[model samples]
Target: MAKFAVIGHKGRMGQALATAIEEAGHEFCVGIDLGGDPAPVIGQCDVVVDFSSPDALVGNVKAARSKGVPILIGTTGLEEAHFSAIDEAARDIPILQTGNTSLGITLLSALVKQAAERLGDDWDIEVLEMHHRMKVDAPSGTAKLLGEAAAEGRGVALDDKMDSGRHGQTGARTPGDIGFATLRGGTVAGDHSVIFAGNEERLTLAHSAENRMIFARGAVRAGGWLIGKPPARYTMHDVLDL
Candidate 1:
């Protein structure tokens, strides 16, 4: 059985990952938390799954690369610099990074891409997401993933077309723009919906996460899939073979 190391071992996702690894018949090699160094234990692991804060990402990637261990990053709210670090590390070791690890969300992204491609510019696209009250990021990472999928289908940059944080005196909606709405509440696992609004009809695609175990299970599966793979940047789509 594969040995798995979990980063952010004290957080909600980390705890869930621990249970998932055991349930998947894998050995839990180590768990690294805030201020804990992973380099000491990374060599013992077949793969590393990180659900830690953004601040710890660079160090975590470095440790995994040093040990030549593949890593699956489930941490959200990453900035461009974080991606740059991941990209650099990926040159030496396999790396899978995603905002959401749910198998359903991966399929949802593909469907969103297909829908965006088939629909004309006349349809306005909007993404809505809700998360637990403790989640710090706005427009949850899953929402951005869906928006990126839509943008990919439309053959445009999401940054140029993304419209978020609408308030006071915002004029008419821009054509071909993708909008995002976020909601935070008590103990929500997660909920995401993408709406395509046309002249006379509307289509909404949605996914609701019942619990954290779904993500945990997916992460475990991804970690297993990544073992012994070639060094490269990867996504959940690769894990699902989508």
Candidate 2:
């Protein structure tokens, strides 16, 4: 059985990951939380799963690389610099980073990409997501993932084409731009919908997370798949083969 180390051991996702690891017949080697250093325990693990804050990402990646352990990062709210760190570390060790770890969301992203490719520019694309009240990031990472998928299908950059935070006097909608709407409330696991609005018909692709276990299960499955793989940056797409 593979030995798994969990970063952010005290958080909601961390606890769920622990249960998932046990359920998957993997050994829980260690759990590092706030103020705990993963560098001390990383060598004992065959794979690492991180659901910690963004601030801890660089250090976590460094620790995993130092031990030559593959890491699966599920932390959201990451900035470009965080990804740069991951990319650098991935050169030495396998690394899989994703906004959402749900298998359903991964499949949804594939569908969103396919839909965006088939639809013409006249169809306006909008992404909507909802999360728990305690989630700090707006637009939820899953929303961004879907938006990125749509942008990929359209052969454009998400950073340039994304239109988020609409407010007063926004004027007319820009053609070919992807819009995002975020909602927060009442312990939601997660909910994401992508809408394609055409002349008269609207098509929506959606996924609703019933519980955190879905993410936990997916993360554990990905961590197992990542073990002994070549050093490279990866995604949930690689795990699902979509």
| Per-residue lDDT of candidate 2, residues 1-242 (tens digit) | 99999999889999999999999999999999988889978898899999999999999999999999999999999999999999999999999999999999999999999999999989999999998899999888899999999999999999999999699999999998999999999999999999999999999999999999999999999999999999999999999898
In angstroms, how far off is 55's CA in candidate 2? 0.5
User: Model 1 segments beyond 4 Å from truth?
Assistant: none
Please report, as a residue range, the 10-residue window in candidate 1 with the lowest summed lDDT. Answer: 132-141
Error of 1 at 95 (Å): 0.2
* Structural similarity to truth (TM-score) of each candidate: 0.99, 0.99
**Each model's backbone clash number:** 0, 0
For each candidate in the order shown, give its overall lDDT on alpha carbons. Answer: 0.96, 0.95
Clashing pairs in 1: none
RMSD for all candidates, in order, please.
Answer: 0.6, 0.6
Compute the lDDT of residue 187 as modeled in candidate 2: 96
